[model samples]
Target: MRQTWRWFGPRDLVSIDAVRQAGAEGIVTALHHVPTGTVWSPAEIEQRKREIATMKDGSPSTLTWDVVESLPVSEDIKKQSGDWRAHIAAYKQSLRNLSDAGIGVICYNFMPVLDWTRTDLAWRLPTGGTCMRFDLTDFAAFDIFILERPGADADFPEEVRAAASARLAGMDGARQERLARNVVFGLPGAAESFTLEDVRRHLAEYAPLGADGLRANMAAFLEEVAPLAQELGLRLCCHPDDPPFSLLGLPRIMSTEADYTWLINAVDLPANGITLCSGSLGARPDNDLPGMMKRLGDRVHFLHLRNVRRETAGIPCSFHEAEHLGGGTDMVALVRAALAEEARRRVAGRADASIPFRPDHGQDILDDLGRQAQPGYPSIGRLKGLAELRGIIAAETHAG
Candidate 1:
């Protein structure tokens, strides 16, 4: 695997020097300052490339901006609503510009309204470290009591609804505001995020667009972009839903293996692929991480290697970000399977044989306790994760 780190431009708290010290060979980033659904002019992309390669003292970091973690697919494109066609045109143009700039892989998600949902940004752990968590009960409280979305009550079980009521009752105004902010925080560096009103309005708009509708829309969007991607020699990979489940009555079209299988077959183009995120897919009890990697490895383009420890056996159950190798997913077996895929690709003389993967998110520990670059991207914590994954890759290679 080729090691990489996600950098949110110059504004990111983690500097380029830190990434090099953490031993990342490549940087995964985007023109986050640019608005969604706009063309990434070559000049803009060139400027970003220069920024990625330069350091604080104007020295070379020697790290290439290899993969685009996301060139965001605008919400208009997802619903095929206003400005949809224009957005697709912009998307294709961006792809062409990126290819011209020597970037081959682009990671994007078609998840509606929200990218990744988490109820707690920093939940406490027994070791005094903190990690991101998704507690169903807390989410339900936000859904039913705080947001007060129409028909939100029917979305949860009676037991869950009761639990949420109790949870909401205990929360004072300040606590409720904090929960609302966390749930609707949107992407870390996004230009804008949802307010309470924004969530309600988006939910109303999506009420008529069911899962089937969203899936069809995703297929159409891919049909428009995937062929262009193939022509440009770019691999376009869709990230799985964060929790791999439905939330706030929104349709989750890319959560399971079946969903990914559907996506892989949608456009029938090799450019269409998967970003195999172990932590997100592993949130569901029955996902079978290593098995998915083995079966879908051929189309896998990018990897988010982390783990989650589910609190219960249920589908919408709670889970917390665990240590990279400590969660339920078999990290050793998954890494071994990735190695196997690399071997097969090598045998076939594939150009993208070695996949680029990041440490994903890590627990907040050590220097992370007081200050934070991002809520989940603790520099020291991710360094620890990368070291562990590096050791696994070494052992897996030796065994192979």
Candidate 2:
């Protein structure tokens, strides 16, 4: 695996020097300044690349930008409404431009109405600094009582709804506001934020599009773009649903293995692939992480490694930032499967044998919280994760 770190470009608090200090050679980033549905010109791509490449003293660092975390998909395209064809065309052109600049992997998600959901952004950790976590109760509280979207209460069981209402009743105005912002305010690279009215409007747009409708829209979008992906030697990897389930009555299309099968078969293209996110899918007990990795190994172009702590019946599952080798995933089996796939690719003389992976979400520990950066992408936690993964991979190689 080639280690990479997600950077939000020049405006990001985490500098290139900090990324290098974290032990990653590749940077996964995007042109955040550019709005959605616009073409990313080659000049813009190269300019961002050069900016990251050049060091403080005007010398170049070996660090290279190899992947784009996402090139935002316009809501118009996802809804497949009027003028979406133009947006789709522009999206393909962006892929062409990115490929021309040698970016081969693009990570994106197809969750309707939201990206990753978190109840608390600065959840206190035992290590002192905070980490991102999702609590079912917190979300239920939001859905049933806070946002008070029509029909939201019906989404949860009666007991859960009662608990949610109670929780919301206890929360003060400021705490409730923070919870709402954390859930809907859109993390830097995850999704775009919308005002309360804007969210309600977006929900209205998807009201006509159910699970099947959203799936169809995704397939149509891929059908138009996958061919270009193949042409440009790019692997388009769709990230799995964050909670691996529906939220606020919005459909989640890429939550399970069946969804992945549906997507690849719908497009019928080799360039279409999966960005295996362990923590997201692992939130659900039914998903077999190692099995999914083994089954989809041939098509997985990137990996987001993290872990979540699953709870028993009444308890809510909280996402803890775990070491790569100590997480909920069967790290050894996953590593073995990934390595086997890489070996097979090498045997076949495939050029894309080295897949790029990064530690998805990290604990906000040490000096990372002191400095301002993306919430979940703290330097020390990720550096620890990368080092753990590297050691595991190295040990596996030696054992072989």
Candidate 3:
């Protein structure tokens, strides 16, 4: 596997030098400033590449932009709504631009409204470090009392709904407002922030589509773009839905193995692939990470190797980001599976034999507390994760 790190461009609290120091061989990033539906100009792409290669002090960092974390798939395209066709054209053009610039892999998700929803940005762990967490009750509270989405209570079980209600009732106005802010909070520096009214409006737009309708829209999108990706030698990987289930009554199409199978078979192309995010998918207990890697290895163009411990036993339960090796997925076994898949690819003489992976989310520890970096992307925490993962890979390689 090619070890990469996600660097949120120039404004990221974590710098390129820091990424290099963390021992990452490649950089995974996106032109975050570019709006969702807009084309990523070749000039903009090249400028980013240059920025990644050159440090703040004009020194060569020698790091190449290895993967595009997202060439964003707009909600317009996801719903096949207003100007969706134009967005699709723009998406294809972005792919072409990325390919022309030698960036062959693009990772994007089709999750409507929010990219990855979390109730708490800094949930304290027993180890005295803090990691991002998603509490089911808190999310339900947001759904029921805060955003007040119609029929929101129907989405949860009676017990869950009651718990959410009780939680909401106890909280003061300040806590409620804070929860709302965190729930709708967007990625820092990404063009995804949303106010409460903005979310309500977006939810209204998605109300008519439901789950099946949304899935069909996603399939239609792949049918148009997958072929172009294949021809351009670009591997377009769809990130699995975070938490892998319904949220705010919106359908989560790419959550499970079956969900992936549906889309992959629908498009039926090599370019149409999966970004097997263990942390996101592992939130669901039934998602066998190692098995999925083995079964879907051929189509997995990118990997996000982090872990989460499920707080409860069910589908829509709570989960928090755990250490890379200590979380739900078996890190060592998953690494071995990845290595075996790479060996198989090498034997088949494939061009992209080595899949690029990054330490997805890490706990905020050591020097990270004072730095106030992006929510889940603490520098030292991710460095620790990368080191641990690198150790696993080394052991696996030696044993192989």
The lDDT of each candidate is 0.91, 0.82, 0.91
What is the clash count of model 2? 0
Candidate 1 to native Cα RMSD, angstroms = 1.1
Candidate 3 yields a Cα-based lDDT of 0.91
In candidate 1, stretches whose alpha carbon ends up further than 4 angstroms from where it belongs are: none
Local accuracy of candidate 2 as per-residue lDDT tens digits, 139-216: 898876777788987788787788788888899999888898888857485435677677788888898899988888
lDDT of 1: 0.91
Clashing pairs in 3: none
Ranking by TM-score, best first? 1, 3, 2
Residue 191, model 2: Cα distance from true site in angstroms: 8.7
Candidates in order, TM-scores: namely 0.98, 0.96, 0.98
Clashes of each: 0, 0, 0
